[model samples]
Target: MEPLVVAMLLLLLARGHSALGLGGRNMWLIKEKVLQAREQRARDHVRGGQRWSSAALGSAQHLEPQEEFFPQPLDHFNRQNNATYKQRYWVNTKLWEPQGGPVFLYIGGEGALTTYSVLAGEHVDLARKYRALLVAVEHRYYGASINPDGLNHRNLHFLSSQQALADLAMMHAFISHRYNLSKLNKWICFGGSYPGSLSAWFRLKFPHLVHAAVASSAPVRAQLDFTAYNKVVSRSLSNPVVGGSPECRATVGAAFGAVDEMLARGESAALERDFRSCRPLDGSGDYGQLAGNLADVVMGIVQYNHELGIDATIAHLCRLMANTRLGAPYRRLVALNANYMERMSLNCTDNSYQRALEELRSEVVKPYGVGERQWYYQTCAEFGYYQTCEDEGCPLSRWLTLRSEVDVCAQVFGISASSVQGAVDFTNDYYGADRPKASRIIFVNGDIDPWHALSVLRNQSRSELALVINGTAHCANMNPPETGDPLSLQHARQIIEEQIGDWLSRRPLYPL
Candidate 1:
């Protein structure tokens, strides 16, 4: 038991917040002259619609964007026994507008830098219209960055949040030093969702390196109420507007319930076969019916509100589900059912505590409402992450008791809870609320986010804590139009950009 506990401890310690350890806790004051220079640069960039003034553009102007491919190794899941292979990554800088202003280091989430760069260009003033040169980079796990082979779970721990933080800090430093802007430049980091958490963590670990951060829809809390999000999905599915007849919800609920029973009995054979046998979502399952099935499930989770007509939604899924009739009611219903199925699968695989929590919800709280099955509960039991209630029937009261010992291996930071907590604690102590540091960290969460409303659970410095309820969304509002901006919810992109712009300008934040 001691050894097991020790191993767990070591694993946790080796986890995320690598940037904090690497960046160190140093209180560096910006020189008065540097402050004046940065202020001037900010004004100039905002006025000139560029990141910096013409005077700020130095030798970088003559130096074209360096387009070079750098091959790196990737070893996330593979253990260290086989031969190591190499993957490729490209590093380059464009002629950014914020030449003399603060540098915006945008590290993209889970895709090629180009993919994220497009999103950034749309939401942000890429011409350095308001701030500094935007330096975007790719995530290590995705794209060209890769680890070595034969690296098992233990070794891959290096790929945790700590390493990511260190990587971003290093990138910032590299650009600062290379561009000779280290003395003249200030750093502002921003990202959404996975990258949003990364942005928040970056400021926490590298306060000295960064001035402020804008984290949108960041999932900082490890244990969140994902089951609640699922409830939203069910509610939406049952709504009549989307063609969900009264029976639609019950039938779908029954199907999921069947799945739940199978999981409780430790039977995944049926699901595995169902997944394989499910028809294609489109008219045919050329890519395989399973592909369409997976899409329907995931789309429901993302809840992407497309202007595409209901017929299009129905037609697309029907094709994926291999249903020929574009107007078939059964196909439409099945498509919505696929949404619940896909989301449950994701919650089970991506979240560590999702499965056990769902089981508990079903046993305890579910009786009062609907005794429906969720994907997370079934997946958890099937994957051996947790067990179901037995003998005493529904042990709802004891459901919470099971969580204390449950070990969740799935984490975005690639670290354990304790180590991540330690990293956060270090940040709080060093650059906490009372600290008179020039930099201020702002954390934003959509009220609907599972991780929302967790300030009560954690000890947050109230002065340092800033929560923005974006009309019940999942992430932070980047560019908000005053407090009561009346743009459609789908137009969150504009709101996000405006808000971040305000932060960079050091303008007063309005409304609540």
Candidate 2:
């Protein structure tokens, strides 16, 4: 579905505002939604006299056996302290010609590397075209690349972007020696989202290693209070060109206004009962948590919007919103939440704010740190992309202040607001924000992505290109090519392909 239409539906239903505040519940809802969508799609296929099976859904791409590890320094900056850890990585040489072809290296970010396919369809296609080797390296302190001691506050000091990039550089050298692929002189770094930012940074900091980079939906800038995120969400919802209905927009706005009035009048109890919150709404902290949780539902759907995939799109969500049986704004929101729950296949049972916070705290030490705690640690210590409703025209309630998000950082990691602010400032200064000291990097972002505002939207150098796709969402170009893909996405992919080809045809000019 078009981003604008989905935005309109979310706005009208106030699904992007606040609903259930439970993390587990949200996940459960998403999982259930995806499963239901798959089932329905399968039924549609059966009606059309086509065979439908789970294998069909899983046939998009496959990864090779990824049981490789590289020895990495615990601290890249302090070489004397020789504490080392194993960093995981994957390599696919099926398409590699070995006659001096470029290497396509995917930089993993914040999650388990095992989940990443050694070859995404599009990346595989690119490798075939360039006769390039496909490689994916896990970031330090993520996935199986855990610190030998543990992921305590003290151990996490080595998990910064600088160390991660150094790890990648070392991996490049290790792979070259291990595989005897030194003839493949050119390297092109590829990644999506946070890894995208890392890919661009790798090119910038270690140009000798990476000849070019493809940063899909990368947010290079560091902002403590990223209010622009919600503003883009608002714009995407109301854009007339994309078929966003003004009526829906106005209705959502009015509903939020009513919510603000209720909050002002101390109707927290009434809200709790109406919204079916698992816990009582006693204070601003609770309210902010609720708002953030609700906002996450909308943001997640919008971010992962795809054309031919079962992933929830704005169109699917809008249809669900229109057909919901519930009455009253609060009831309508609850129903809409159920719609997302069905669409995303999330199997959450409890929808309480307290329970969600507890789950976050408990999952800090889990493998790959899949919980919010690990990502929050990066935000507090490195890039502060805190999605706050501190700006005007935000869809969420004003009561949901930026301080609440900062408080989470402190509560989770024992870090202070001042320290987070300092870290953000340092990151900006170190990376050069949108105007990084880099070249031969292609920065791609969907116009509808909330994080697009924080990304480099304009070419800062001759070789650095920023391409934006219309009516698309985060990392659309990175996904497998679909027949229903928008012209903009297709065009962006073509440009990326051309850039990679051109970069490979040329020799590196060192000592820039």
Candidate 3:
């Protein structure tokens, strides 16, 4: 296989918090922000014109239960240990043909599998098309697929990608045996973002288990300082393809630079007052955290711009920034902060600056949730794809630095920079780094997605293909097709279907 393709397969299984989609742990933050924005807009419209009540924002949709549990070994590589834990899985065989059909396995990522709804729509459509059985397996330690031991540093040792892949292989065997479907040999894997990486890795590691795979927005390469993430965000905000405004981009750039200058001049009190921070900025750590949060807000908007509606678009953000009525850069900054607060339903008396600092602290300790802790552990152990502002050219450099990121990691995981480096090196060496040997996998990524830069964009073999969709957001092709979708996305979906169909039709040399 080509170097990029191999790297793609290796990197695909690892999750990055910088990107959007169901695969990352930060998706809850994105979902809440978008939902709150929509709700606030609806309320504003009602107050302005007529009396009306909108449906509850961010309400959960009722999904029929297809869940089950299987006992998975704690250490797949060590049979002597003989410890097992329950692994959660769901099956939707409603679209399957009676005799024998292809099984479509949807791999889970960093977050709880229950929060995963992307599989219910587009994957369901794909399953119906192929008359395949749809199976969704929750990653070990995520959701209810908890390890018998608590999720401290000790237990997380078992939560590696290799172990997760082993879990999938065992789950497949159990499912086949339980359903009496051993004769149904064809199995296809589908996932987006981190799970997208998993789907690709599944085929690469166990070709005999999975005949084909669709890995959407799967970043295959791991880097210590992921400066490309911010670079891509900057490009997305200025690119005409995404309807970005030059004036808006200029205003944002200036605002970031201005903030940096102010902080450098010891204007923390003024910043606290202007930005409405809950607490005073004590040191560079607090300032850096605030800056990172602001950058995350911008990235989150661009990552899910399609779902946030026109008001949340790059053009819209630019319009807000460039408005003469907004007065100085500080005022524009406040306006931007206010917009994000309202959208995220962050109803604290503390300003955005304060909240940003608090959020950073929370992410480090991750006391608020398991997903953050679990995902961060993976990063510390296997991949150090820390989304840092290493690129000086990027606007985000005003507030973040590589030092701050490394410090956060040290504080959170009790590991030094050298330890992280060692772990990253080990991961790269184990997973083949840039020379992965994999086949029969379709890698898909959107041009605008920050993670796309890390994925395979070239054909490595006849069976390994890369599909890049233009004028699309993260994992756009994996979602249900919309009337407003770009032609490239539509074409990508068609090609994926064709490739899968071809894979399913081929006879397997080895019997199940």
Winning model by lDDT: 3
Candidate 1 C-alpha lDDT tens digits along 164-259: 676676666666766777434567777765567677778877787887776666555333222333344344444444333434444444433343
User: Backbone collision count in every prediction?
Assistant: 47, 24, 6
For 1-512, candidate 2 gives per-residue lDDT tens digits of 22442343235235433322222234233423433443344344333433223342233343234468778889889979898998888887666777787788988886665523454545655886887878988877766788645466667677789988889888988888876776455888888789999999999999878889999889999998888887876776665544444444444444455555565555777666655566677544455455555555655665555432543555544444344365544455455565554544444323355655675565345553342556667988988886665456776545445565666677778889899999999999999999996889989999988888988998888899899889888777876565677788788889889988887887545532
Per-residue lDDT of candidate 3, residues 368-477 (tens digit): 22365677667777777777654555755344555455555666567787887888888667655534568898889888788887777888888888888887777777
Q: Which runs in model 2 stand beyond 4 Å of their true positions?
A: 1-63, 240-243, 263-270, 279-283, 307-311, 316-331, 344-357, 368-371, 508-512
lDDT of 3: 0.67
Cα lDDT, all candidates: 0.39, 0.67, 0.67
Each candidate's root-mean-square deviation in Å? Answer: 15.9, 7.5, 9.5
Clashes of 1: 47
